[model samples]
Target: MKESTGQTIMIQGEQTGILDADTVLITGNVSVPAGGTLTFLPGTTILTTGFFGINVEGTLLAEGTINSKLVFSVADTSGFYNLYDSRGGWNGINFLSTDQAGDSSIFSHCTFYYGKAFGDSINKMGGALNIRNFSKIRISDCEFKHNKAIFWGGAVFAEESDLKITNTEFSDNFCGTPGPPYGYGGAACFRYSDADLTGCRFYGNSSTGIGGAVSCEYSDVLITTGVFQDNFSGLGGALGYLRSNPDRPVSCNLFTGNSSLFFGGAISCNRANPSFINNTITENHSVSYGGGFYCNDSAAPVLINTILYGNYAPEGQQVYIWDVNSSPSFYYCNVQGDSAAFGGTGGIGFNSPYLYNTDTLPLFSGIYPSPFTLSDNSPCINAGNPDTTGLMLPETDLAGNIRIVGNVIDQGCYENQSGLTATGRVNKELQILCYPNPFRENVTFILPGEYHGNCSINITDMSGKMVFSSSSMKGNSFNWNVVTDKTTGLNPGFYCVSISAGKVNGSALILHVE
Candidate 1:
């Protein structure tokens, strides 16, 4: 491997044909020239032999289709592309420095797999990249599997950059230090940056300290229609946020399912105040407190039309809002769980949750596999705020479906309908759903198609009471607020959500409150 100090290299510009080499290696550090394009033809496989691989400084636009997918992996003297052999070798590719002006670098339809690491810092670098300070960067249709980083970010470590990520799958990435002061993240880590992630799936990863799936620190992230399941971390199981700043802590975008350790088993926000609306946070367990959420000394999270079910810890469980100064508010929010009530604690296991509305009990009656179904006559059906804005809801869910329908707002990320199934399921069909049932606190619903037009969604409670609602819907989702009391009002009962168009027919639902 020859070393090059310069930062400009042109690969196949006026030249075409396949540049097939035994090892397409980068010696020292190489960068593409300004406004230059490096194109990789079909059936192009590049191999490197350094601590780091090809580092792109300028713009990189590598587009590969299904049949002729681009591959970035290790090389042996025997010319074998071993998938499971990580005998302390090398990183696949590295993109260090990017162009300042016109910072729109994109990587699409690529597969980064089977990278490894050893100790401290970052051992085997990026499976595909490690970028910094770039704008409008897009990575889509990519698969990062069986990649390992010693410290953080299994597939990619994007820092101090504004990026848009979509349709990416990160699986089987491990980042766990067994000894003292352990730290690791199975997936990506965002620090001091702004990013929007959509249609991404994070599953089957393990970490030691925090954030097995994703970690956000001192940054603003918006996640829409993403799935986080079966990921494990010591502190925050699926997602973790550790922001030092009191006023402007790191905030992650809305949508659902972030299981954690002490607080927010599905999603945990330590000192952050990210908007959380219309998400399903369930089935998360904590060893001590906050089966679903554990907040302390932080700003009160704004929850609208979201569902919290089957989340459990020990003793005092569910949402534990302790030491948080700001009073948190929940409008048409549903919290359903079971309590064994040890040590004469009683039936309720939820600790003190800062309330805007005082209905803190689970509204419906039933058990898992079918708890808050509309057919079961659950109170969560239509209990929502009628005054939520379009800015609160997402443009679409993970499968690119719209979020709002008629004037009705469904609960959680996926709209509950009579017959709808979750993504990545074998029998993609639902048995029961919830809609326009009578809401009191908040209303949640799913959209029909991709929401591309402007719309508004609202909510109200029983006895013709209007509590929360909103307009300015920019996308397909909606979370209507109906909580009237900021501190301690709202008797446990039922609620409703009403949706509308530009002078068109509306819809409604009834929700059960406990």
Candidate 2:
């Protein structure tokens, strides 16, 4: 099954059905044989020649949805030019093989611009594309502009691979190639592989010497719902995690950002213990060390509910959790600017770690006499950590509802919940008023009256079985003895009567039968 010379071969180089060539004009160096299924409809346009354009190995179903798209630019047939003049022109899709493992290949809703990378190094121009080693790729909602991987992954160069990127976009990828010892990730470069990024977005990339956007060694990433902006890495504008062995545990996968970088800008866990959650790291910019984050030495990162605003490395400010053995811990967090560090590099607390609820976590609403302005009752408003029930929350923010009740789940990535209202916050309204509302079995639980005394009456049966539980039900009233028939008989449905009284806990609405 090897016959794909170029210039057009839909069913000719087929493996199944309809792929009648929407535009397959690969002018040089081509080879896509191995049970291929390369489909590219929806306003299609494919043209490659700078060096190595589309070389899949087999099974490449170029998917396109979200409003017609599957363009791989670079052939204007003169027509007066100017698609940005066709930029560098080649190197944006290469899934080679020496038997590089298996897994359905797909490049969804495609869009890669001015591609060029494959030699002078940067892994090849910004390393436009070269994912060897046991491939299993799936790049989603793609978009990479001004491609340049002179070496690295200005676009992508994953080795020993198994990648899955979503909602993609890696901006201004640069790095003119320089590895060996010079620096790291000008845009993206990983070794000893295992990547899994989600909801991706890395902006304004730049890496003169070190990871301007990303560079992971002994790799292991699992980033989620992303946004790494204004990237610049002399060290780690957005990422730079390295690890040889300290018990060997270098693993990344989570980082939160809303307004993105200016320095170690959004992340720099140079030792690795990655698992940062809920991000909205703001206003980044560096001067000396880390402007937004810079966890060094024994990198320990497990920060949950993140939000650090107005970041700046003003003469060495913000973060610099150095000295290894790093035990970075912060729950339901939110830290404001100005982390002192003059002749005495000490900002955001150097050593002596272990801190909890930092002043209940930035809960200020007023404190600006001169230029200290912090108007709208600051305390970062509504403060976060609604206790985070079972964790894993983020269904919709960035303006998409369903995040949490009252829309109050702020700490980053936006979720103001608009006109949020909970009024008389406490008083849970008699803990949620319910006087046997619709009860049957000799029901009685009227504890509102400002609720008092000993109480603990549970009667769950919505599958949460616990048919009944009583604890000396004293005060307001409590009585339920409809044992229905010894051990099983009542067949009426709906049942949940949780009553706590003392620290207030209420729930009622029952129905029983026999």
Best by TM-score: 1
Per-model TM against the reference: 0.64, 0.35
- Regions more than 4 Å wrong, model 1: 1-35, 49-51, 76-89, 117-128, 179-181, 244-263, 297-299, 322-328, 337-379, 398-401, 417-514
| Most lDDT-accurate candidate | 2
Backbone Cα, N, C clashes tallied per candidate: 71, 35
Write the residue-wise lDDT of candidate 2 on 1-514 in tens digits. Answer: 2122224642222233334455666666555666655556654666764444656676566676767677775664232112223244675666656234434777887887666654433225334566766457788888876666544666676777767887788887765323444435656776777777666778877665556667776777665556676777666677777662222222212232211233365567667766555565644656565666776667776655566544555444346665535656666656543233311233344453333333212221112221111113234334566676644555764334445545455554444444444333333423333344333456566675645577888776545567778777777776565655243555554465667766555554354533
Candidate 1 residue-wise lDDT, 1-514, digit = tens: 1122323232322222223432244333344566665555443454444434455555665566666555555544221223233443345444455567744666677777656543334443333456566655788888777766656676666778768888888887765456544444668777776877777888876566667787777777776666777777766677776672322211112222344555556555667666566666665655556656555445455666776654556533456555535334556666543222211121233233424332233222222333333322233333445555554455554334555443555555544343332223312211112343334555456554544466665545434455554677555565544443341255544344444544432333334343
Q: What C-alpha RMSD separates each model from the true structure?
A: 15.1, 18.1
Quote model 2's TM-score. Answer: 0.35
Each model's lDDT comes to 0.53, 0.55
